[model samples]
Target: MKFKNHILVGVLLMVNVFVFAQYGKQKKADILFNKFSFVKAANEYRELIENNYNKDYATRRLADCYAYLRDPRNAARYYKKAVEQVNVPIEYYYSYAQALRGIKDYKNSRIWLERFKDSGGVINANDFEKDVNFITSVFNAKQQYFLDKVRFNSKFSDFGAFEQNGKIYFASSRDEGVSVKRLYGWNEQPFLDVYVADVGTKRNVDHTAKLKGDVNSIYHDGPVTITKDGNTMYFSRNNIDEHGLSKDKKGISNMKIYRATLRDSIWTDIEDLSINHSEYSTQHPALNKDDSKLYFSSDWPGGFGGSDIYVVDIKADGTLGVPTNLGNVVNTKKSEGFPFINNEGTLFFSSDGHPGLGLLDIFGTIQGENDEFVDVINLGIPINSNKDDFSFSMNPNGITGYFASNRTGGRGDDDIYAYHRVPTLQVEGIVSDAINTKPIANSIITLFNDKEEQIAYMVTDENGFYQINIDRNQDYKIVGSQIKYIDDYRTFTSKYLQTELTTITANLLLNPVQDVIKLAELNTIYFDYDKHNIRKDAALELDKIVSLMQNDYPDMVIRIESHTDSRGELSYNDKLSIDRANSTYEYLISKGINPSRITEHEGFGERRLTNGCEDGAKCEEKDHQLNRRTQFIVVKME
Candidate 1:
């Protein structure tokens, strides 16, 4: 069992040239597998396994075939058997772990990943382990896309959509009824060809035909990008010429990027880029906003992964510069390809290396402070699935685009989907007091759409934090309110959301009610010397409390505390303070203030004196008067 057989299994499906066994049947199946014909090769290997002819080799080849077919369930099943055999190669442990991930069996995936690491297999195991919660995070993320299957999708693979000058160019394996039919060995479908369609509106496919002239080849071709003027095109094709495919020393024909000129509505002047090499593949060309740079994916040497995205300078003379790999920020230890650059200079690509929903999810880049791409963010759900998703291209408007996926519920093995971005606008922040800056827990935050109708509302947590998702391109108003504070109003619109998900910080500062009992600056209510009755001046102060509770804060609940001067005995002072508290409570009740509004009315006696008027202390008359005072505490304000 060779380790090379387990790596680089698709696109440029490189396999070790060694014969699995000396038997004729094993040799035939090995040739089929090497030709990227996993469908036929799987059948052959399955038959050999049934007959018990070199069962070990047949079983291993069968697992590799299913893995190429993107059937992870069957792949995991066979890989389990292969790894359980004697003298199992180290690659099977890693491959089996990946297969388990494809089926979302993360617990078992981690087990195999640890085994692979323990066996000294330096692969994506470390990264895979760190992404243990990746699936959960992807599913829980805000939905960023609404997808629909394009009408032009066929029973075969239809994908790679690029928009140019009101026309849509894509790659498809649909049989076009050509008298001489050619089929790709990979899935028995017709060889992929570039097709053009007059798409007047988004996702509308009418008037379709093959691209004119030398662009479409008998071998795989297309998934093309055109210049702004639509006169120049760049596309991917097999590394072949007029004679035959140019094979490397290992007998493998890799992919290459070609440039063509459109003359008189016919494409011609096809020239292979100088950067292409026979040993590796460079495909999926995407130009920047100004066309000064071209980005593509390749499995060229010195890359960080099986395939990595690279860029080259496009000179005025229509030639290319030296290729530079996008560093670890964009490229990982696993395969990444299908680069697309939007007008905003944001790079989008597909990757199995990054944490995503499952195998090969689309990811976007976040730039650092130095204007270099740093963080890679998964595009998340709908746009990604538990299967291969790639070839993401956006239209000039930047809101609508197309990508390909082999996930379930598609029209074919690989279907092209037209997606309109549903801009995710998240309003989040803390609701705090304007004066104290303390979190106003249990504050109500309400969201209203453009029509002024309340869409949703939520209560802030103990930390006074809240978050809400709003629709794109719509005006919204978020209001925060608490019982004791005035409403905080904020209005914004999502019409200019630049990213797939835009987060707006709407930290609210609520103003506390000026005369609320909690913060009210009132003169202390005093009493005559050692008297248990409310004084005339004290009645005036108590009336203020009554008016605030009755007219302004009708739902105010309060607690009253009264104290006595320290000149009297402790027991006598305690009784006098109690009488004063009752008198004040009765006064508020006589003014029609609700009795239940006073949750607690108790005398603290001389314990909580406002002045230094303790017993046996020398104090002025005013000092003792300050000690014999009643204070109001606002308990709840609705």
Candidate 2:
């Protein structure tokens, strides 16, 4: 079927599958490789390598074989070798990073991903900042999910689950004898068919059987979304006509949505929905509360690109209204599909374009006041993986859900995993000016979990109040940032222990940036005669300046200027004064200030004196002391 995973993993199963070229003898491996039989491909490649047939080429192919086979350990080992070999493809480096992530070696994965990026040529998305931040926050935020591969999964691919009438219905590609004995050229898996089984236990599914109707065709029959009442259904199927299957201009068959009605335990009156297009594919249908709106993924004309989530009104007569693209916030130039709308109206979908760990990562977005998907949030890990993760479903209960993934440890190619949200502990507070206690509104407050990874970010309201949900019994860091003010950061733990700060009231303080820019008085450094070492009093004074620059005035630069009385040789005074300036500059460097921000420290020697106590000029000791002092110049500010 025409597919685009353009949206996610599901469509990739059919569309854009790469075919390996035929190599002369033992075309054996190429056949299996093209069939998506990674396991067999790896074995054959290993044999070829053992026979000493172009080890470098075989090794790279072998690594790719293992990568598709989902054996990350072996994939990582061989990919490491492949990346170092000559003529390695840019994609090989990305595959190496993905393999590393599959093995939970994320730090190393980051290293290889950087290498892949540095190797140039756009291997990953540019929008990775939010994804990186989200992954960091999940580093130690106690695993909230207890995942178990569903028992009903076939040895082949099985996913896209939904519940109705105490029976679980899902899509699978098990080669049941009754179906047509044809293998899909893309994956060599049997054509997908919808199956139903009695509601099984959490770990095991009861006996299963294919749906009895005109649903399963000789061609691709995939995911189905049914209404709450279970009478109406929208499913994906290869575009077929009375003359048989139809092909688009690309010589590829397209996918279309077929609606059916269930009557007396049998699905009947099947008909194509109006949202389909002959030029593009539309699949993965979903619905809102009253089923008045039908949502699905499509690559029809006028889309941003790939597939985008589109909603159409389900008219009273069961016809589709005009489809509206969810827009750039939810859809990107890349694929975004497999939409699941929860009861709360929040749209959950998977996309490769959004900031993500890798591949297709799940993102959540709700319609804002303007009725648009705004501020999409990556669902984080366990729900997401470096591999393709799509086809998410959350029950109306608001806690339990199911999602599909081909990550490291699945029972099948794409298994459905169950998830339940754990209770969350929340932190709420107000931010204000430290000195006057005035509310600091609209400040950005970031919360980092125990692992020092940011877990949540909030903007203070007009009242300076903010709240964020967090995991219980874990340590956290709250950092507040606002323009023209210092970052207000605090570290606190969320716990119920007697000694813990359970009744937290983090009314943060943000010192005005302008307050620190006036540094002349506070920036003075005094040195004993002929001594360039920083003194205790001077060291204490520098601490305040360092803190402000590091916390608030990040773009500010300072210069340390030293002057001296003309009591000694001109050259001696210049050298001594420069030494004093160097001593002060080094002090700030040791305190974590960037050397670039220090600009340059210079000494004018006796050329410019604060007092006339120079050469033969008579002056009191205080006059000489004034010229011995060091002063700071605000070289730049932002």
Candidate 3:
């Protein structure tokens, strides 16, 4: 009996030691997993499972590690083993359901999801409803129709898409018959060129050719963006000079960023971007939806690892500020790149080290103040695959996503694919005047989504045309107004509509009002040098005048009087002032004001004076411009 007892005690001690060792390994794996060191964590978990200690716990954790690594095939297999064990935790059911979802087994996923709900778990029903809604939408006929219509034929790897002014700009590596292939490090495909496609017909892209001129060079140039006016382009290019040229005579070395101007519908000379350099690679530029800020990926010094996301302010003059790291919340000690920030402040990025579905998967988080990021979530399954997936772009509405993926069925090493958020509705329309059958220009239109929040605002163009984009799942109240015109409000709700382009026209008729007529309250108007031509600033102010006249005194007729300083010859200055007043008069008439409602103009040359100025006065040019002005005086209150 004593001999047996000794042997048993020795066996217990060995078992305890083995268990402790396994526990330490599991703890280490958990730590790395939390920090988004997914590859390392997966390896650690795999070692624990191989040791065969606490098989249930080790298998479960290993499955989670594989999920983070974006290896759903392995993740699902191990998760199956974990769920087969007796008395599994409720959280394990949720995990298994996610694995099933990642593998596109929605029916089985629903089974596990329902089991989780029945196990006295307090799940957020709204989130489950959203997932279900999205899945149902994806399985719908319309989604399949769109998928069938869009072809994936390409000659090179393409990505980093952006849409502006009904045109799509993206990066590609296709050969343009250039002799030497651009090379970056060991990667032979360093030649990235920017290409543009017009969405003129809405159904297809007009890829008639690459963007006009030096836009497509022999260097790696991509991730292009344009301001709201479409005059200036901000793009990333690699190579030679501080002006974005290849230093090598061959024009195919190094990488940097540059800016170019668009004149006469063609890209002119290019200037090097002042913010980046060859010492550290900076690529994948994304402008904020408002074009107020710029985000990009950089492998510069002081970063967490291989690369990280950085941002800079876009000055009004188109200059970029000093780049600032996005901090640890959005970045890790591993590779973090391909960042995209939407209009709603939601950030999407691709990371190799984060807990995801595969080698590199896309992730999303909400940006917080003080350069913080929170609520990190993995974009699972179809959106993220087991292969390298990066370079994603989304429409302002966030309903559509375009990304580059090397997944099984593609045209080349990488191809562009577009995915639409399931169950989305669209809000679109045109803005016009009430009285005349004419479009309005410079009219501000605001759209408020179902959450009673402003989602988008657009101005009517010279043709009085505007389109407001909205998510399909919600209701919206749209309001359109212009200064001097009555505000027009309308409400509409959308259902399941899969049309590529939905057209909704909301015409507004603003009746003229006759109440308050306050003049002299206007600020001084500005004019061009040596001419009475109305400047843009002057037109903006005159818009206010039109608004007041239409809304406050619709039937009132007015006389526009032009004035000039005492410097110029009397007749010349008088004629200049008269022309200036007539210019304002013509603009109002073009904007739908009745000609009879505006009386004739008078040029009070040097007669009217706020400041006594004889010939050769030492007044500033600003003051003199102010003296050469136009005024609208009420002629008759109809």
Candidate 4:
């Protein structure tokens, strides 16, 4: 028994030593990270984690180190592990969510954000609001619904995928005939091509067509994106033509972005992006959803790394402006490439130099203030394996993702694969008059999500239709109303898994009231003198009155009254006021109001005066104008 006790003591001592060693390593890593020696810090933290000592703290630190090193995949892996093992602190959840966002997994990121919120985590709502990528992700989910898949395999190399119109575009070198190629001074096949397939049905490519371009010849053509209208195409091209090759005479083996015009559904007249230069290698061009900005990967001088992502504004005339570095938060000393910008403006890129799982893995971040990137996160595995898993693409909805890997098993050196993504929900509907089966144009619709947050509000179109997309697994309340009608309220619940068009139709009925009510609330009623023409201001006032009547007192009717000052004969003034009131009534009718509900004009020729100032009795021009105004009143409040 004494011997056993001694053995136990020895084991405890060894454990203590291990723990101390881990603690010492962590301290050193923290110091390194504090000093901005993120690479060194990541190494130390990785060592500690590998030794399985102080794993939770070590993993957390490791993740932080990786983030500082600009390696989000490894960072995310450790963060996920840390969260799973213990009650993850709010900070950890925030970090994890950020990592998920880095890879454009906004749905999961949102889930984590909610978790963070539930754990009493403090977040600046404004920060989230300005996060374009996050906002885009939210918008995508609310706009459409679909099941997503993350395809994996051990074969041909696959990289990034982009969706435009009803087609999927991606980059791959799987069909390379040569056994070896070279990229960025690395030995690899020189063959990379941009391929497209139909994305309307299941995630299947009917035929993989290579992008047509001389610049795409015998080099890498990848990381492609097209404009929203599919009129212009932008992509990365490595190793320029012999005429523009580098000084070394090796075909100027650096990458640059090229543009092409899509005419009659075919790409024509390929042109180099005006922003490209021979001195710096630029690749992986991605355009914002609005095509207002271009983001790309480069190793140009004045950058932070072997390759860093850069952005430039696309001017209205299709000219490119000076490129701006994405800043140190996203760029590191190591290479960062293969950037993909979702419709929401979240940035996804791949890096080897950052603290990551192995060589190269996908990472995510968002553009922050001063054009800096914040919340750098690593995508965790299966998405990121031990091997290099670079090149990522996502749909506009932010649920599904596609990336390239050389893991194993494929038709060639690399093969493209599709992935399943999370689902999102949106709400859309129409508003109309209860009496008429016609579309209600410009009916106000307000949507409040389950979080009791007013997500959006919009007016119906000429057809009285409105739409508000929201996240799944949430309850929503919609309030619809228009002028002269009672407000309509409806409720709905949506889940990601559900596939159905959710619609809300609200019909409002108005009750008949009196003719010629006072227009006390209106600011002005602009009109043409002596012409009885209602101006823009007059139209606006009529719209407001219509909205209140429709939404607040749907069952109530109203009357339009026109008044004239004593500047003219009583007969002339009465006729003018009557014409003006009728004109106002006609404008309302044109705006989709029920004509039957509106009573005829009640022209008062200088008979009523609130200021008691007669037109010829020292009345100011303002008073005369006020007396000549048009008024609307509820004839019936039902």
- Give the winner by TM-score: 1
Candidate 1 has a TM-score of 0.49
Tens-digit lDDT track for model 1 on 1-638?
01221221221122111112323455567555543345677888998777655566578778876665556788889989989975566778877777788788989988987898899877542656564333233223346578864787777888889987778899988866667778877778888899898774435342248898889888889789988878889999999977877888898888999999999999999998999998898899999888889999999888998999999999999889999988998999999999999876778999999888889999876553344664566777788999999999987666788999999988878898889865445677778766435567789999998889998878875556666666667898999998778899899887876754446778899976655343464456888888978888888888888877788779776768898889878998888988888888788888998765675668888898776667788999988878888888765565
Q: In every candidate, how many clashes are there?
A: 0, 2, 18, 53
Q: Which wins on TM-score, candidate 1 or candidate 4?
A: 1
| Per-residue accuracy of model 2 over 1-638 as CA lDDT, tens digit each | 01211233333233212111112222456445433344566777887677544355568778866654445788789989988875566667777777777777878877877887888835436423223332222222345455654677767777788766777778888866553467778998887888777666454442248787878787877688889888888899989888777989997788998988888888878898777877789899888878899989998878897889999998898777888888787889999999988766778899999878779988866343344543466777789989988898877755667888888888779887877655334476667766334466779999888788877876775546665656567888999999868798889876653322223556688876754436654567777777788889898888988987888778777767887777789999999888887788788889998776665677778788865677999888777777886788765556
Q: How would you encode candidate 4's per-residue C-alpha lDDT over 351-456 as one tens digit per residue?
A: 8876667788777664432335555656655556677777777765455657766655444455555655432234655465553334556577878877778877
TM-score for each prediction?
Answer: 0.49, 0.47, 0.45, 0.44
- Model 2 Cα displacement at 470 (Å)? 11
lDDT, candidate 3, 341-396, per-residue tens: 76555678899977766888887663323325643566666777889888877766
lDDT of each: 0.77, 0.72, 0.66, 0.64
Candidate 2 ranges beyond 4 A from true positions: 1-144, 177-180, 201-208, 425-638
What TM-score would you give candidate 4 relative to the actual structure? 0.44
CA lDDT, candidate 4, residue 292? 96
Better of 2 and 4 by TM-score: 2
Off by over 4 Å in 4: 1-155, 174-190, 200-208, 212-215, 242-252, 367-371, 408-412, 423-638
Q: How do these models rank on TM-score, best leading?
A: 1, 2, 3, 4
